[model samples]
Target chain A: EAGVVQSPRYKIIEKKQPVAFWCNPISGHNTLYWYRQNLGQGPELLIRYENEEAVDDSQLPKDRFSAERLKGVDSTLKIQPAELGDSAVYLCASNERGRNGELFFGEGSRLTVL
Target chain B: AQSVTQPDIHITVSEGASLELRCNYSYGATPYLFWYVQSPGQGLQLLLKYFSGDTLVQGIKGFEAEFKRSQSSFNLRKPSVHWSDAAEYFCAAFNAGKSTFGDGTTLTVKP
Candidate 1:
């Protein structure tokens, strides 16, 4: 089976520009997660989806960051007028329900804000 | 709040040498533990996991981790290091339907 797939492996944009990242979770997976990983740091959870419902998104910056999972399979994360500090790797992961949290991750979309 | 910590930011080992990467977690109860490896420009891959049974868990790529409840630690170990083992290692803890990851440790294997 194919792993989680993310598009635009690398992206470069200027500050105040809008950027979006897409993720396609593994087939039959019921849970999806979006995480941000700054250089030299571990991945931090941005949002989590159980099917089409976003169960945890408290960590997401509502002012600039928005995410949606359509049909409980594909997810998109958007950052409007992104700041320079937003440069980092956006990682998408997924797992089956009741699987003890074993997550399968994607190659990640690395964004660079100039 | 549940959290994970990896004290060593970087480690260097010679090929064929033994390796150990330390991981510590804080939670109200014993949480599900895991070790993941990330090669440069690649996604994170699961190495091993510790749930409820045995303290020692073996994983892919000749990696193993020992879960110690007394120490609140789950340390990854390899008896023989290989050059391909050079990568970033992350420790994670899952509880209450949430997962937390620690700052990774970069391992450099010398030939």
Candidate 2:
């Protein structure tokens, strides 16, 4: 089976510009997650989805970051007027519900804000 | 809140040498532990996990981790390091369907 798929492996944009990242989780997976990984740091949770419902998104920056999972399969993360500090890798992961928390991750979308 | 800590930011080992990467966690309940590896420009891959029985868990790529409840630690070990083992390793704690990751440790294997 194919792993989680993310589009636009690399992106470069200027500050104050809007950028979006897309992800398609593994087939039959019921949970999806979005995480951000800064250089030299581990991945941090941005949002999590159980099917089409976003169950945990408290860590997401509401002012500039927004995410949505449509039909409980594909997800999109958008950053509007992104700041220079937003340059990092956006990782998408998924797992089967109640599977002891083993996650399968994608190659991630690397964003560079200049 | 649950969290994980990796004290070593970087480690160097010669090929064929033994390797150990330390991880410490803080949680209120029985912790679900995991170890993941990330190569340059790649996504994180599960190495091993410790959930219930068996303090020692074996995983892919000749990796193993031992869970010590007394120490609140789950350390990854390899008897002999390989050049391909050079990558970033992350320790994580899982609870309520979410995971908290530690700052990873970068491993460099010298030939």
Candidate 3:
């Protein structure tokens, strides 16, 4: 079985520029999540989607960050005017329909904001 | 609120040596504990999880974790370390609608 897939394994952008990452979840997974992992820290959830509907997005920066899962299979996370602090690994994960199921993760997209 | 704590930031052990990583958690409700491993430039992989029943849970790659409810700890251990096991490990606690993860522990294996 294929695991979650993400694009642009690495990205570099200057401050104030825009950056985006994409993720493709495993087949049949009903829930997808986007998380940011900082240096020496565990991943922090940015958003969660139950199918195509976003169920949680409290940690996302509303001013500059936005995410969408239009087809419920693939997702895109965008950060406009990226800041230096936004430099981190963006990890995409998915789980079964049940909330307590284990999550499967993609390799992730590492972004470097200068 | 739920939270996890990994006391050690980094641990180094020679190959074939036993290894143990400490983790603690805080939550008001019945806790769900998890362990994940991340290799360099890779995503996090589930190791094991404990929701209820047995305190000892076995995971992939010869890993195991013991959940202690009274102490609020879920510690990961391995009988022998391997070079391939060098990576970062995270402890997470889940309850209610939210989950919390520890900072992480980086394991270094010596040949």
Candidate 4:
């Protein structure tokens, strides 16, 4: 039983450059989530997808950040013209569709904007 | 809107000593609570969760949490702390469309 897998464990990009992170959720998991964790702070929900539809994305910065979970199995989060403040660990988690279940997380992609 | 609060920023405990971390949540209906732990530069791991049925829920690693509906609190405890337990813990709750998380508490275990 493999867990969620995220690519490019660490990334460094210029402030004005574009960056993207990818995640492959666990098999049979119907729910996917993207979270941003800042220094000394908890991971904040950025977006959620139940299959191909993005159920929630109010917290995602529409101006620069965009995410899509095509086919509902894998997801990619992109940040264009990245800002210094955007530097943080981006985590991807998966869970079975239900009332409430434990969310299994990947190692996460740590981004650093220089 | 649902939100979680962790009052403690950091706590240090000696090995084999009792440990407790506080968590408070705000929600409209019945609350669904969760505790997650993360090691250095790692992703968050589920420690435990409580939806209903029992006031006290036992989690992995000999950790347990008590949910007090009246006080809107769900504090985690371990009778005897271990060095491997040192990590950052987060409390979270799901709301209308998304989940909210606390800032987190960093635990340091003294050998």
Cα RMSDs, all models? 0.7, 0.8, 1.0, 1.1
- Model 3, B51-87: lDDT tens digits are 8999999999999999888898999999999999999
DockQ-wise, the better of 1 and 3 is 1
Could you tell me how far off, in angstroms, the CA of residue B36 lies in candidate 3 after the best superposition? 0.4
Ranking by TM-score: 1, 2, 3, 4
Docking class of 1: high
For TM-score, the strongest prediction is 1
Question: Candidate 3's error at B104, in angstroms?
Answer: 0.6
Tens digits of lDDT, candidate 4, B1-111: 567899999999999999999999888885688999999978899999998898999999999999999999999999999899999999988656567899999999999
Give fnat of each prediction, in order.
0.78, 0.87, 0.63, 0.70
Model 1, range B8-108, lDDT digits (tens) per residue?
99999999999999999999999999999999999999999999898999999999999999999999999999999999999999998888999999999
Candidate 3 CAPRI classification by DockQ: medium
Per-residue CA lDDT of candidate 3, range A1-114, in tens?
A: 989999999999999999999999999998999999999999999999999999989999999999999999999999998999999999999988865737789999999998
Q: What is the TM-score of chain B in candidate 3?
A: 0.96
Q: lDDT tens digits, residues A1-114, model 4? A: 999999899999989999999999999999999999999999888998998899888899999999998788999999998999999999999999884647999999999999
Candidate lDDT scores, in order, read: 0.96, 0.95, 0.92, 0.92
Instruction: Give one digit per residue, the lDDT tens place, for model 1 in A15-79.
Output: 99999999999999999999999999999999999999999999999999999997999999999
